[model samples]
Target: MKKLYILGIMSVVCVFFGSCNDEWKEELHSQMISFKAPVGSNGVCDIYMRYQPDGTASYELPVIVSGTRDNGRNINVKIGVDNDTLYHLNTEKFAVGRKDLWYRQLPENFYTFPSEVCQIPAGENVQNYTLNFNLKGLDLNEKWVLPLNVEEDPSYVRNIRKGWCKALLGINLYNDYSGTYSTTLMNIYVDGTTNDPAIVDNRVTRVVDNNSIFFYAGSVWEEDENRSKYKVIVTFNEGELNKDGNMAGSLTIKQGDPTSGANIVPVGDCTYELIVQKHETKPYLERHITILRLEYKYTDFTSDPKNPIIYDVKGSMTMERQINTLIPDQDQAIQW
Candidate 1:
């Protein structure tokens, strides 16, 4: 009886194995695949770039996929931005988690996505798409969002569980910081209202480092309009200072400025000349004009340049991007 039972169990096991092989072959023809954005990164995030002469900035967005691809079968998947759900979702995901903050709402003319469609070739597991934007059109004053989602994969299955279906691009454009900047010179003979601030609007021949400027006071920067007698220019090492969410940093007060006619007058104990506050807030995509806070005092002509007293400077600045045909930030891609 035991021998007979063993033979019967073996026969059933063989039959089950045969059945699975046949079914797996059929299932392979219609395997379900899911698409996902790269891990640890916003499926969509904006990359800020320096203003270009051509007036445009560009970037690449990548989409990752999973699951088995059919043999000899190339599948076409559709990808687009789902505007319908974006409004319901919060855009400041990066800021909300740490500190409550909102991204800028950019204008419609600021960006251009090359294609609404992405393809998953025969066996390829990844695809990259290009996004082009107009830097000149970007207003640092406003915040923006570009949400990208994977809508359909006729050859695969939609992954609702992993929730990797979308990537939100947070746009933040940057200015060269090369133009003339108005200052608010403080802490001098008139700590708050004495010396009028001068321009730290340093410009360089090299287009790349134009955003940086020199802070120097040869004579006196009077709030009533003061000028330095000798050429005053200073150079220093830049420091990283990020508070809240701004592209802010500090430059150490160094001992020289070669480009200017003369070296910037050095203070007795002050090591740092300026603490730049070029933060981007809502409405401003980048810094149109930044405020410079001086942390030192120099003898000035205001009270007598030869016998100038200690003073600190701080000032307000303003710059506007006048490409005014503004509109609500729109979804760049539509579901297929």
Candidate 2:
């Protein structure tokens, strides 16, 4: 009986050790690798790969090139099975070019190869891959490296426009009644220095009724005040015209705020109300009345310093046609 007990204990120890070995083997079968670029500059090339215990693998390749003062940047990336000869399996190409020198802008013109998957070699429990790339004339000396042992989460980076203000004003006549009317101009005030402060000022303007109604809008950076503001002014004119005509207006909108630096505040959603009054010179007429309500909404807002600040403004107008009892003949003239 004692000999049988000894044999049983030996068998239990063997089974426990075998189970631990199997777990170790499974852990060793999986592998991962991560890559990072040097400091003070964007990454020119980086690659990531993961190997599973089931002989499957995945990879992500990222490439970036530096832009120059005069020309654009180029990026190239390639990945392939790890062999003595370093044969490439796939490649991705992307480029970023400079569009405007005054804006100091670099726009991304290409992007490809988000991810890929493949199977490991048959009968071979281990798998490995190679990454090769060239960035903006810079040669990467590192040819191949083991993938990071930790799993990496998917990531994405993009550039979006922000901090822009757009405003629109439209007036629709209900009936065919011809009369002279003046346009109201908008005034913009901007505080703080910017790469192009004048660029912000030119965004606001008079869009409709160029001959009948005058529009004025501009931005200015005030160093002393340390604040940036945009203003739109609408001026209206009174005159006589042949009765029977309707007018509709529209215009292009652009950025009216500073792109960078301190005191750069984004213009939030806003709306303005305009009041129009009619009066006859022979009869005294004066009253403040609401004529139109203009609402502006900016959908895209970004903190990125490279993009321009632009907003979308939609305008709507409401007119009152009630006759004025105070003035005799026709009706009272419009008042402010």
Candidate 3:
């Protein structure tokens, strides 16, 4: 595959939040290898080999290279496959913890190198690693990956952070998942009790690509003092859908009352995608979501710094939407 990022001016990604700390910020500039692009807005680096254009079975992923400079010149680096760091960073950077991750393999033939030695040119800050895989060797109906970490070199440095120096390659090819699915969010109490879904169950499409979909969850505010808008973000990335044909992905719930979507927390082991008929038309909806129903109780920290609260989330939701719910702008359509 060819390079995707523009040269000489690679863009810096979004600031790592909630999990953001001075130590992490310092580590960002520290000697290490990291991805060049932000993992969409939801903080997930998901690339869907959803389809092959022009009979290509290769995917290009750009990576950032930085390390100690010996004397005046920065050290030239090589990011080879490192089997040592066999774990996801599971940090605030990816907005996901280790427990929430699903790992897979893209078979042995799919190698993570553009050549025998993937090198970062001397004085260059970026290098694109092209994943060469045989599509015919992969099962389109199942999910897979090309998991990697910064293979340690004797001369250069690598980020020792939990989430850094790692890449989870979710490789698959299918693009039928594009639409506004109707949804129902059941807010449960800490006691693990449920209630009727009060908020409107619907999702509006924000952006759609060949292999992924980004959409805002339908939200409503409750009165604590004044009405504030809460937000839910659902992202379906490449190879995210699992073997059971369930839409396996991540969700971010935000309360605007205090932080205006800044106070976000990801619920563990939540929703799944199901296909059903709606008004004589069939569409895939992210319904049948049962939250906090896991055997192991999970706890997470809130965004509060001074008086941070450690809390547990137990909720269920049902999301359903029709394909091509894209509201084409009338003006633009007329222009076309």
Candidate 4:
């Protein structure tokens, strides 16, 4: 009786396996084409590009054929600018009345799509589409987003889930000198009154070039209606080695927009000192400390455009950059 029971169990297992053999050979998932770009909380993929001297940069966008098996046939994926989606995103994120704060579509002159169609060759699972950028005169004041879409085609099945077919690339550029600096020591006061001063904890600097950066004048943040007019450009000169073996240099400060009502002038000798030191415990880490001693005076025109208010700013701003010695890529090496 026990032998007969064992034989019955073996026959049942054989029948189940034989009946499911054909199903196992069938494909379980569809072969769909999609982009590998991942979006952040803001619904845009933030891609960092190292600022170039000539104001040129390129980003390779990845296009992938998703499945358990390799692509069986060649695919020419159609691509285009999805302006409607970007418009909707801006509307959803920012109030319609706050147009100035809305993310702007990257102008056509700023970037060029190398090809409208990305080719995924047979047997390959992915391919990169090159996007060339010319940011020579891009106005960094406005938030820029490059919106892209994967057009539907009979050659391939397009993935519609998880933003696979669409990509909103938030273009961000950084240089050696461009970043947020601690402004705890910096103080702002009314043109003549110095007793009661206002201090901001931090300020962000925008990249002008490899050695130059710009920031809004004291107390005037980016949200100011006429903030661009109060731009303060700081250019670092070639450094001379100090007694401590650290590099120190004079800073050239200038107003960005001359036509504005703000009468900007340097109050004293502007300079900067850079100190480099190795991490205490981590051998593969290095720290760069940049101390900028600034003294300037500028008028805030936007608060009351008709009657501008003059403000005097003084003291130093410090920025620290950490570099990972093991990372080969300069852009990825720096802890941004």
Tens-place lDDT per residue, model 4, 14-76, is 999997986767656898988888988878898889988888999888999988777888889
Q: Is candidate 2 or candidate 4 better by lDDT?
A: 4
Best by lDDT: 4
Query: Which prediction has more favorable TM-score, 2 or 4?
Result: 4
Top TM-score model: 4
**Cand. 3 TM to true fold:** 0.37
lDDT of model 1 at position 47: 47
Write candidate 2's Cα lDDT for 1-336 as tens digits: 999999999999999999997776453321222222221122122222221123222332222211122112221222222222111111211122311111111111211223332223323322333222212211111122222111222321111112001001011111111122222322222223222223232121222222212122222322212122232233233333223222222222223344523222224333223333445552344433322223232222223346534433322333333345465633122221
Poorest stretch of ten by lDDT in candidate 3: 290-299
RMSD of 1: 15.9
Cα lDDT of model 1 by residue, 1-336, tens digit: 999999999999999999997776664433443443343353335444555656677766665555444433455556666574444444435433422234444556777767666665766667677777876644332336666667774556655565566666666444433233433233234435555444444222112222433323522322222232322333224534456443444433432334433333434333233232333443323223333333443334344546544444333232332211133321221000
- lDDT tens readout by residue for model 3, 1-336: 134454322332323343465445443444566655334343335564444443246667676665544122354455555443323333333334333233345556644355654566666777677677655544332335566666667766666564566666655443344333444443323335444423445543322234433332223222112122233334443336568655455433333234453344555544435443433442322223322111112122223435533333334433333333233532112111
Question: What are the RMSDs of all candidates, in order?
Answer: 15.9, 27.5, 20.5, 2.6
TM-score of 1: 0.46
Q: Residue 275, candidate 3: how far off, in angstroms?
A: 21
**Model 4 CA deviation exceeding 4 Å by range:** 14-27, 70-72, 280-282
Off by over 4 Å in 2: 28-106, 110-336
Give TM-scores for every candidate, taking all chains together and pairing residue i with residue i. 0.46, 0.18, 0.37, 0.88
Candidate 1: which stretches are off by over 4 Å?
Answer: 16-51, 68-72, 91-101, 104-106, 152-156, 173-336
